[model samples]
Structures are given as structure tokens and as C-alpha cells.
Target: MCAYAGNQRLAGVRPRRPGPPPPLDPDAPIPDDPGPLLPDDPDDLPPAPHEPSPYTEPAPETPETEPEPV
Candidate 1:
């Protein structure tokens, strides 16, 4: 009896199954999908910082603190 290569790896493989083979998953990152993929409403999206994020911008003024003399 000859051992066929197809027999070694086909467990749970159904015979006479009609349709295209399962699609392969792509390992590469998609160019169109630059990530930080947002959820529809996971609420996990980080809240925007209330203040300006950049240090180059002047610090926001606050009423509680007096401005120090330079």
C-alpha cells in the first residue's frame, strides 16, 4: 500500500466538500489601514488631553495659581 502525501495531513478534512479552499491570512500590514484602529464605541479611545500636548506651546493659565515674577 502506498502512502500518499495528502493522507498524512488531512485529518478532519472533509471529502467531497464543495467550495474554494479557506483563505490565507496576510502577514503583512495593510497600507490603507494605518493603525490605531478605532472601535465603534469601545469607549477605550483615549480622551483628548484637556491641555495642549506639546511642550513648545505655553502652559495653560490656571486661576488657582498666581503667575510667578520672571
Candidate 2:
């Protein structure tokens, strides 16, 4: 006999049945009003500070006219 011949077949295996559904809550009916997730007033947010632009021109370079003796 093969080494795995005595093992149980998995073809008929299935997950166990789940328990009874949770009890329903009658008070969870749809709310009349849904409020915003964040504050409605502009004052509630912090002001963003200004940042320097990366596209600005760089400073001019000074020319070196003299060559050192070898």
C-alpha cells in the first residue's frame, strides 16, 4: 500500500455550520440627520504658511581667469 493510502479523503470535507444570527436592534433605524465628518467652520483649520518657489533663478557664478603653474 502507498504511504498516503490510509489518509482520510478531503473531497467531502466542508466548513462547520455557523451559529444563529445576532438579535436585531429596533433602535438602529435610519437617522434623520447625518452630520459632516469634519468641522463646517473655516476657523477650525490651521493656516498654511507660504513656501519658497523652487523654479527661481540661481545666483550668478564668479569667473576664474587665471590658471595655476603645473
Candidate 3:
């Protein structure tokens, strides 16, 4: 009755330290066709739903034509 609550018969034999269970490299190259997880059936599909380019007008600062005065 004096071993820090861990002397109860050594807790039913606890000692497992085994290794070596990982070795399988048989040429590994299996990937002939793994595409399309889930996305391609919107019925006739033509409206994509991105709508953000009504002509995209936001870059009109042109004023660099001072190189022809040489």
C-alpha cells in the first residue's frame, strides 16, 4: 500500500513495444483516370453563374505619350 496507486499487480502486465509493419512499394503508378469527383450535370449547362464582367471598365489613366519630342 505505498507505490503511488500503481502497484496493483503491475496493472495486468503492460509492456508492448513492437515495430516494423510498413513496406509496400510495388511500382505504385495506378492513376489512369481519376477525374470528376462531383460536378457536371446542370442540365444543358450554359449560364455558368459568374456574372462579373459587364465590360469591366476601370483602367483609363493613359497619359504617357511624351517620348515623340526627340
Instruction: Count backbone overlaps in model 3.
Output: 0
RMSD of each: 16.1, 10.5, 14.1
Better structure of 2 and 3 per lDDT: 2
Task: Give per-residue CA lDDT, model 2, range 1-70, as digits (tens).
Answer: 3333356545655547999999989888886777777788966755444643455654458765788889
lDDT (Cα, 0-100) at 39 in candidate 1: 73
In Å, residue 17's CA in model 3 sits off its true spot by 2.6
TM for candidate 3 is: 0.27
lDDT of 1 by residue, 8-35 (tens): 8455554465889888779866568565
Clashes of each: 0, 0, 0
Model 3 off-target regions past 4 Å? 1-12, 28-32, 43-70
lDDT of all predictions: 0.61, 0.63, 0.61
Residue 16, model 3: Cα distance from true site in angstroms: 1.4
Q: Cα deviation in Å at residue 43, candidate 1?
A: 1.4
Cα shift from native, residue 45, model 3 (Å): 11
lDDT of 3: 0.61
> TM-scores for all candidates?
0.19, 0.26, 0.27
Off by over 4 Å in 1: 1-36, 51-70
